[model samples]
Target chain A: MSPTCKLTYFDAMGIGEPIRFLLCYGKIQFEDIRFDFEKWPSMKPSTPYGKVPLLEIDGKKMHQSAAICRYLGKKLGLAGANDWESAQIDMAVDTITDLRLKVTEYYWEPEETTKQKKKETLLNETLPFYMEKLDALVKENGGYLVAGKLSWGDFFFAGVSDYMDCVVQFDITKDHPNLAALKKKIRELPAIKEWISKRPKTTL
Target chain B: MSPTCKLTYFDAMGIGEPIRFLLCYGKIQFEDIRFDFEKWPSMKPSTPYGKVPLLEIDGKKMHQSAAICRYLGKKLGLAGANDWESAQIDMAVDTITDLRLKVTEYYWEPEETTKQKKKETLLNETLPFYMEKLDALVKENGGYLVAGKLSWGDFFFAGVSDYMDCVVQFDITKDHPNLAALKKKIRELPAIKEWISKRPKTTL
Candidate 1:
């Protein structure tokens, strides 16, 4: 029998969404448990490392979104065909993570003036720098993120794209045709399409 | 013959050290190319993704420190015994990364008052929170970060511990005996000990 799977996170398409995408893509059944921000203070201490997007497989809990996604990717046969390919996938995902951290920094800036300055830098410089490189990579890899095929790295970007845009308040993929196309392709996958259609809607 | 390997990074431990530790631990000889900050402006553009700690194996370059370390970890047989074990190692490494980010945030804060505030919180709350948990984990896992044996996670933490201490202005492992012991053990390994003695000294 399949191991019982439960995922707990806030009710938003943040880091947790990538794991959800992978589970759905692999046709795995999981209980998705989401809570509001108000409950986080009480919930935080109980977490393994005081963070969210936790996955429990067969009563064994694990933290870290990227780690969980990678685990599932390997299990689902979407990680890579071999070690080198997996490394390429990891590199792509880490690059995506680097860009996401910038957006997060801007989002979490408390002061308006500082936030605006970060916003300008992000939109004009950082986004383009990353998107262009990522675009060229996808184009070279035949519309996928790494190793010339679909991997968890693709799902990671697709899963996090909406939350990132919501935080940055911009269409991050506006000019990056390849990134936009990749997102479209992932969203159009049968399981992912169904998951998106049924997943709970949240402001961010 | 071993692939011609080249690693390029700034002349400090930083993220580059983990890869160095892995290579040295595996006894693989490679070119360690270090550069001063003044040269980075011109050098950045030449990097695979405009970052350092870039590893080129047989002329194929890769980016992202964690990704590179993972790749090297797998190749050097320090990753894990199997898929689940690798996932556990990834989780531990990611958790360590989370704490490192907190230290980095405190280190990079510019305003004195804000920096002091962050420092107080870090020392009083964040450090203890993570250290206690990690100390317990190391104890449980037989003085290693994951899987009751040595892994890249150990190399990663040991390699970065000094840099982390330099940034935080605290001996992070002072009270964590298991963590301290793990670092000492990794450092005392023959190749790692040799690498440490021969490595270029820098203030970080």
Candidate 2:
């Protein structure tokens, strides 16, 4: 019997979306509980870490997005074939996370001067640096993040890039054709495709 | 025979130190390459992720401090006994990382006003929130971060808290007595104790 799974996150395709996408791709059934931003203030006190994207497996709740993803990735046979390959995939996922945090900081900056400065840096420096590096990795790794095949890192990065796109409001994929293609490929997967068709729409 | 390992990072006990502590605790011999801040600009471009704490297994390099730590944690039998326990450990490690990044942002913030604001939040809210949660985990898990015995999460958090302390200049553990005990227990391990005695000291 499959384990009962439930996920809680704010109503947006933020970090929580990756876990949803992964579960959908694995054909695993889970309750997707999304709430509005206003609800988070009250909900915060009840969360596992006062954070969203909490996953309940067999009634036991777990926090940490990457950890939940890794567990699901391992369970779904999407992590990697062996320990070394798993480490490589983990490296790629964390690298994408590093890139995500950098981008998110720009989105979260409250002051106008700092926000403009960060946007310039993101557009000119940070995006180019990470895009070039990761684009090359995708090209070299046979269109996937690691081991020349599909892994959780691919889905994770693909989901993260969507959030990045929302933050930057620029066609980030224009330069990184390979990564763009990879994202398209991930979206085209049967399970993911179906989920995308049915999943709730949100501006973010 | 064991694999030949070489670790390259700046001449500081920052990200690289955890990798060292893990390797030392496992009694794993590795070449520790430390360079000063002056060398980083020239060195950065060659790194796997353009970041330090690069672990070279044999001759191939891998990046991402958490990924490297996870890899070393697995190889050293410090990950956990099984996948479930491993997931729990991963959860704890990533939570600490989230805490670390939040604290480090204060250290990295350049604008005086922003820095002061972040510092105020750190002192009044953030540190206490994480410390209480994690300290409870240590106490509940029988004196370790996960499981009843030592795990990599213990060492990783202990290492990270030292970095956190360097950034905040506060005795974060003064109120969280259990976490303080956990840190002490991790430090008292023979290998880590020896490494601490001999390793070059850096403020951060």
Candidate 3:
């Protein structure tokens, strides 16, 4: 029997986008469950940690976007074959999520002063640090983040970098040529490109 | 040849403790490397993402405590058995880390007014939400966070809850009785109990 997979999240790109992208690109059949903000309070109670992006598979619920992504990645053959490579994929994806959360802080800060400080920190401190590391990893693994193929990490980085460019008003790859190239390469993938173009456009 | 691992951080029970606990409890032999605050600037360059709790495995380096913990957890059979249970464990551990990071904000705010507001939010919003959810998960999984076994999520929660009790100046499990019991149960594990007793006591 095909497993029942339903993704619960608001109609935004926040955490749900990666899952959507992965499933769509892989042609995996699952429900793209979105919720109205008005319904979240009641819906929140059912979630594992009172957060969305919960994946219900075969009557079991799981939370955490990274965990959900990894599960889907493994199921879809996007994660690597062995434990070490899988850990490396997890490391890369988790790093992207960390950087994305930092960018989110720019939106969460109350005033111009705090937001400005955060923006500056992002530009000067956080972005370069992550970009350089990503560049090194891409270079080390021969342009892919994992095991010489397009693993979930590549898709995650592509999604995150795209979101960062759209939200943070900074060109992430301007300085890091290799990371820029990596994003471009992932974007050029036939299945990924098709999925990106045809995918539902939502504000997360 | 056995791979050698070295973990470097400040000699405190702050961010580095969870990784240390995982390493020790898993019986994985690794160097418990520490550094003085005075020497951090010089030390930061050697780290990826310019952060500590950096793990050097057989001459290769990896950063991010959660990533390291998850890697070691999988390596030592502490994560979970299959894809789904592993995802649940990851979700729980990451949620606790999220809550812990938010709690850290109480200390970082420079102004007393902001700190007070953050403290209030911590008390009213964050703590109860996480406590209730963790309590539910513990109860649902039959007194364990994941896989009906003592996974790293249990230890991660124990470390975070212990930190909350000691550092955040709040008894997290006061309302959540199941969470309180799970914490007690985790604390009484022979390996964890022995490690907790021998673990160097420090204030963050």
Question: Interface-residue RMSD per candidate?
Answer: 0.9, 1.0, 1.4
- Minimum summed lDDT over a 10-residue window in model 2 chain B is located at B57-66
Point out the worst 10-residue segment of candidate 3 chain B by lDDT.
B158-167
DockQ of candidate 3 compared with the true complex: 0.73
| Model 1 agreement with the true structure over A11-74: per-residue lDDT tens digits | 9988889999999999889989999989999999999899999999756678898999999898
User: Candidate 1: deviation at residue B133, Å?
Assistant: 1.1
Query: Where does model 2 exceed 4 Å of error?
Result: A1-3, B1-3
lDDT value, candidate 2, whole model: 0.86
Give per-residue CA lDDT, model 3, range A135-198, as digits (tens): 9888888889977787888878877676677667667888887788888887787877887787
Candidate 3: regions farther than 4 A off: A1-4, A35-46, B1-3, B58-60
DockQ of 2: 0.81
The candidate with the higher DockQ, 1 or 3, is: 1
Place model 3 in a CAPRI quality band.
medium
- For A1-204, candidate 2 gives per-residue lDDT tens digits of 554899888888879888988999887899898999888899999876788789998567788888888988988989899878999999998898888888988998898997999999989998999999999999999999898999999889877787788888876777999899999999999999999899888866
- DockQ comparison, 1 vs 2, better candidate: 1
Better of 1 and 3 by TM-score: 1
Tens digit per residue, CA lDDT, model 1, B1-58: 6559989999988888888999998877899999997899999998878888899874
Candidate 2: how close is chain B to the reference, as a TM-score? Answer: 0.93
